[model samples]
Target: MHGVVLAVLLQATMAGGKHDYNAAFKSADESGKPLLILVGTNWCPGCVTMKRSVMPSLLRKGKLSEVAYAEVDADSQSGLAGKLMQGGSIPQLILYRKTSTGWRRKLLIGAQSEMTVTTLVDRAVEQQAALQAESAEQSVVTASHVEAAE
Candidate 1:
């Protein structure tokens, strides 16, 4: 009973951006959805542009409907921001995709245009689908080989 309540609370808190980052990651993992993280600071002009304009536009277009998205303020979530960032640029976008073997990570630094973000998400989703198909095909082939041996 308590466990179920806690899980419900966690899911409720992870609806979109400006929520608990850890909760968002857990939700994405449990749902098998790709997690999209935007790391930025409030004072940065580029970061402001992304947070205010670019992301909203993508959301409106439904490009992000399939993703679990989170926004991390670099100033407040410095520890998490540091771990996700590869460069010193603000507004770093990170995508975590669950594959057959493990989680795949992709990153884009600096403020990006809507087209760039769309391309990254679309490409990642497409690649994940291809991987799933390949994995399924391998399983079928392995089963056939085992049956033939038997």
Candidate 2:
């Protein structure tokens, strides 16, 4: 009975809170993927709306697999939220790209609908592809230059 109660409490606590951004970012780095940060407060209706309506639709339509999704609570992680977003508004969606500058923003601060979210995700994928192509081209150019020098 005691163990059962403890398990329930643990689940409740986790469900009631926001995601761990550091951990999520680490996972995305490991997977060589982008990261999506959804900043929201538990009591914020807009946040809840985005989570339930926009997020699920994107997920269902296979629009969210290329990146990792994480949620930060504005109320709980106010300092982190403030650093990321100027206004500290709920339902702030941020896309991050891993680079020499660390997690740089690809997009910031928008009112998200399902279509808008899908379009944003598609844009992120396109950006990633462009970066990869540029890197490959650079490598090819470097190899050719090295061969000419030899």
Candidate 3:
């Protein structure tokens, strides 16, 4: 089961252009992978650097294989972008992970380096795995207790 989940996450594709928040969210939910959003406008330099340099480099290195990614243009998708932004700069990389209790959000404001982004992704994956493992263990314990009662 763990292998299957990891495989699904690693196999998740990252979309470069023409992004839709709804679609990306749906895909992440269905695939059990975290949703990663890059919010920026074409005019923003930091945004450009993220879209052109950072993201592509990460994708090439297979660092972003475990998450569903989307690029949101703040100019065009202002409504969605405004909602997602936590009062920060142009280039904001937001990650939404579904945990055992609910959704967990992590945000990085401004242009970030490859190492920084990689660390963020790695931490998210690790946290998610830990939460899932704990959940599974609880389920097993609950099942055993119920069986003994029966």
Candidate 4:
């Protein structure tokens, strides 16, 4: 609970950034925003480079200003981090969108440019919106069918 609150505050502090798994997941689910999780180890040179260069560059460019971003240390947050590492990649970017079944994820491995992240995020948002619209349409059709049956 405290973590969630802190995470919310963290988001507010850093323009939609959260380092806590629960915080990121909950916010993403609740707000219908795609969650971008960065998984890597602290000692990893790639991770350090990404942290020092790629992320900050994107942030400066305002590419990630509205993003629900989360950074996870693989060694510390094994539970959330392990699942993303199934493909055997470090400095992985995992984008998650909440769906009817659960969260659907898309992965981008290694360090990436701001343009790459921007393009991927744009597509993810569009895809999620389309899925949701389809689901809503199905729900309405199902309701109409049930009404017709009565």
Best by lDDT: 3
- In candidate 3 the C-alpha lDDT for residue 43 amounts to 88
Backbone Cα, N, C clashes tallied per candidate:
0, 0, 0, 0
Between the candidate structures 2 and 3, which one is better when assessed by TM-score?
Answer: 3
For candidate 2, list the clashing residue pairs, or say none.
Answer: none
Residues 1-150 of candidate 4: C-alpha lDDT, one tens digit per residue: 999999986775564243666787777878787888888877888888777788778778877654577888787667767876656678898898777788888888887777788887888788778887999999999999999999
Q: Candidate order by lDDT, highest to lowest?
A: 3, 1, 4, 2
TM-score of each: 0.77, 0.79, 0.83, 0.70
Q: Of the candidates numbered 1 and 4, which has the greater TM-score value? A: 1
- Error (Å) of candidate 2 at residue 143 is 1.4
Write candidate 3's Cα lDDT for 1-150 as tens digits. 999988775553333233557777888888767889999988899999999999989988999888888888888778889999989588999999998677899999999999999999899888777777898899999999999999
Question: Per-residue lDDT tens digits of candidate 1, residues 60-144?
Answer: 8999877778888888779889998887787899999999789889998888999999999888778767777898899999999
Worst 10 residues of 3 by lDDT: 11-20
Clashes of 1: 0
How does residue 13 of candidate 1 score in lDDT? Answer: 50
Model 1 scores worst on lDDT over the 10 consecutive residues at 11-20
Per-candidate Cα lDDT values, in order, are 0.85, 0.76, 0.85, 0.78
User: Per-residue alpha-carbon lDDT of model 2 for 1-86, expressed as tens digits?
Assistant: 99999999799668644446887788788865788888877677888888677786787878888988877777777898887775
